[model samples]
Target: MEYELIDNTQAKQYEYHIEGVLAKIEYIKTKDKIYLTHTEVPKQLEGKGIASSLVHSVLEDIEKKDLTLIPMCPFVAAYIKRHPDWKKLVLKGINIS
Candidate 1:
């Protein structure tokens, strides 16, 4: 299965659409930080790893832009915890174990 992650800058969200359901990670940006605010996936789409894919793609884009992250969204924070390599992307000021 192919998953395409699209950055909808106007909406300030990274979106993934599959089988007519939309999964997205919402963010708010400052000069140097992108605060990941929320994530939502349809009930039918849960457990398919779509949210993980969305977060990963969004983090990759932020890394490429050289912006740090404030993972305000619980889902995003948990994902980063599970995948420690992604921890490097978090903003230094916000302490996370």
Candidate 2:
């Protein structure tokens, strides 16, 4: 499912708000690559699949824009590991193991 992702570029995060809660994936972008630096989901929202959805949508957006990803955040790296197809979206030197 494609969720609404607000790329708050000024803040350098992609935010998803639902049920009065905010989930975000923070990143750094340089030239053709985006380094996913962190991911946050409110404590109350844990175990509810919010993070997975957020990561999925963010990856989709990154792929659509044809930008390479550097999954600096452990969560994002793990997500890529679980979903191997997305690994192709990652930057060449990254090992999402």
Candidate 3:
């Protein structure tokens, strides 16, 4: 799927758009950690794996910038659990449960 991923810094979110629907992963950044706050896919675009892809790309960008992750969103937390390699990007001393 060739989805267009956009880092909408003004909105503090990463958005992936396909056709007219959008999937977004919201975040808040601090000096060293990016707190992922929410993940949402339009109801019309549900069950297409868009949420997973959005978070995957978002995490990749965070890794490239060498910032830690604070998975405040349940979806993002579960994503890190599935992709153990991303666990290293999570900030220390944060309870992910």
**Of the candidates shown, which would achieve the greatest TM-score relative to the real structure?**
2
Candidate numbers, best lDDT first, in rank order: 2, 1, 3
In model 2, which runs have C-alpha deviations exceeding 4 angstroms? none
* Per-candidate clashes, comma-separated: 0, 0, 0
The alpha-carbon lDDT assigned to residue 94 of candidate 3 equals 69
Quote each prediction's TM-score.
Answer: 0.91, 0.94, 0.91
lDDT of each: 0.89, 0.91, 0.87
Candidates 1 and 2, the one with greater TM-score:
2
- List of clashing residue pairs for candidate 3: none
Q: How many backbone clashes are present in model 1?
A: 0
Winner of 1 and 3 under lDDT:
1
Worst 10 residues of 2 by lDDT: 88-97
- In candidate 2, how many Å is residue 35 off? 0.3
Location of the lowest summed lDDT over 10 successive residues in candidate 3: 88-97
